[model samples]
Target: MCSFKLRPSKLSRYFCENLKIMQFKNTAEFAKKLDAQDKLASYKDEFIFPVINEKEVIYFTGNSLGLQPKRSQKYVNEIMNDWGGLAVEGHFKAEKPWWDYHERLAAPLAKVVGAKPEEVTVMNTLTVNLHLLMVSFYRPSAKRFKIICEEKAFPSDQYMLASQVRFHGFNPEEAIVEVKKRDGENHWHLEDILKTIEEVGDELALVLIGGVNYYNGQVFDIRTITEAGQKQGAFVGWDLAHAAGNIKLQLHNWGVDFAAWCSYKYMNSGPGNASGIFVNEKYLDRKDIPRFEGWWGTKKETRFLMEPEFEPMPNAEAWQISNAPVLSMAPYLASLSLFDEVNMDLLIEKSKLLTAYLEFVLHEIDVELGETTIFEIITPKDRGCQLSVFLHGQGKALFDYLMKNGVITDWREPNVIRLAPTPFYNSFEEMYRFGQILKQGILEN
Candidate 1:
């Protein structure tokens, strides 16, 4: 197994070249051929690809960061030209004005999340928005001061919750309840989650959960969980960084109090791009919620008035603490335009087939090999494009081998590889090819 170097073996090269030609010949020729007939195949050409060794390497890391759209360069260039030509006046004189630039993005993002125009705001990064939303919604009373979250939440969120508790003079270990999956289970049972809520009813103040878990790729039942929390009189919010563009969401109709997500993943925005937040319409009229405010959060019409008093704009905009970053949002606009070409329904349909195809191929290889190859998928079947696979202890070695061979999936710490075939740009062929390479890696090792 250690004999397998980082260099692509002769076997790998032969496999890649033959697979390329065999990619579109027949349905029986694995799923790669199916990509040739895919209705959304044209979408792949819309994005820019980085050339490594003069080849467009297979990219399965979209769940972490999506490939840049070809249009993004043009979009950012336009912003650059505007800023250079108009200087400070670019606030209004430019084509996509700096002042209302963020608003232009809100419509497309709202369309993606199934929210009303006023309910969504493109603002801070995921964890920051989560903290900001908590400032307004996580109002704990003397008796109800506990917060609920997943046992294995993203670390930044854990830190955010800990700090939020300390800010209120409470110990996180005592006041925050982490809902855990049973031993040997990949996901938390809905009944058990509800039971936890029931047991902590009066003490729970907020229930914050990841829409799609970062580690296992489990798409949690947001509506069900939020309903349970609301029944217990707890405020419900979601961290949608993994689910926003990867899965369909109805934050407003689901009756969630708030949600936040970054645009960089399946949304295809660039690295560290601006994120979005959602606030239900029911809170639109409630001005009493304690909030962190700035001039940007003030009413747009009188924003220039510069009054010392902060009168926040209605809905999600009121949550903004600063002006939108112009350059950072240009990529979001470029990515969102691609979404306009293909809506969630079509993309999701393709995604289901793609993921199911991957599962079928992996299982087929496992059966043929007649050995325990040490790869077990840990994500739930109901998950989106991402599939988290657990390797039997040799995780880092396998991950490095896959990267050297250009099968670019992301590895989480300890032992998990996350492979996401983004519906908008990824193809059936890519999934099939990855399975083939992965199978070869296992056998060779």
Candidate 2:
């Protein structure tokens, strides 16, 4: 379980010495060799990838919803047994008390998002947590009354921002600043984003951008963006729904004021699992911050006293609006335990190599077909497991064909196919096969 920690010089040397010999190829034999050399290869068996027609489906939709962990059932059964035996006493007396269950998740989740244990907490769904954090962070005064966000942010985020502005009696159109890519381009350039931040410097009350652009799969420079927004005297937050568990983050180190992400994506938690939130430790004791709080957020010592005066916990847990749903959280624990063992440093390195292989295979398809007619990868070089491929034409038919052939990729509106090769469960062999299928698909279409 030791992580591969190498300095830049040594890492380069290691790559040249070890990885150069393992050159990526479009053949199945090369895929096998890569898989054989993969230290994380054994991890693929930990999850239950979907099977269809007596064959294992090429499940590449982890960016949408990750496959289930085998230990999830065991984790849930423990809670179920506690409910059946201890009943109400399970809150205090169970093996892992339901009352303090969420606390157990905080430390491991902190590692995932690169935050202090006191800065992160697992609680409500992503949108709910986003809105809750906004109630505290989106404090717009007379001069700073605008929010700068991405134009192509998730639909729920767009709706949430609009409603938040409207709730404050501000016109959504006037108070919300949306930054879009240049015409004819799918990815956002860093210079353009920095320019926009400068343009809205004075009026920007908040800057809430997706850590990774979901549609185009572009990873943003969080530290630089946060610094830029802060220089403009604006609170900086992140919607990490598409970035969490897939990419390495430093929410606290980067001075990200707050962030929220769903656990079901690359986290490998069950569907609709509890979301995690990070509130920087600098704001931990800011009693003036207006958060939507509840009993669960009160200090543990006096929480049972119910004295009517809310004494909030001196950590990110103070933002909790209600007691966590233990059932929904159990499976997350099972998955988090695995992350703790394997660690993000290793996972992130493996992810880069695996996705690079996918990209290589895709290019090979273009060459094999002797045409640029297949599809174009819109995802940038710096990305996580997911790659967004823009289909040339009649994408629905090709998508349907892929689905029927047991390739489970995600299709967005219009003509984008998102292929996510989860490092935890997906294999190099699958990437090679997908390239072959995609070439066949393009030719048939």
Tens-digit lDDT track of model 2 for 1-445: 1112222120111132124433456789878888998889998889897776677899988888999999999999999999999999999999999999999998898999999999999998999999999999998887789998988789999999999999988999899888888898888888888899999879999999999888888889889999999999999999998898988899888989999999999898888889999999989966788988899998989988987988889999999978879999999999999999889978877787777778777766766676455667888765777899887765699999898888999999789999988889888999989888887887798
lDDT of 1 by residue, 13-127 (tens): 1112112222122134545457766889998999876665677778888888999999999989998999889999999899988988888878888888989989998987888
RMSD of 1: 6.8
RMSD of each: 6.8, 4.4
Worst 10-residue stretch by lDDT in candidate 1?
A: 1-10
The collision pairs in model 1 are 23-33, 32-429
Candidate 2, residue 14: CA error in Å? 14
Which runs in model 2 stand beyond 4 Å of their true positions? Answer: 1-22
Clash pairs, candidate 2, are none
Q: What is the lDDT of candidate 2?
A: 0.86
TM-score of each: 0.92, 0.95
Worst 10 residues of 2 by lDDT: 5-14
* C-alpha positional error of residue 353 in candidate 2 after TM-score superposition, expressed in Å: 1.0
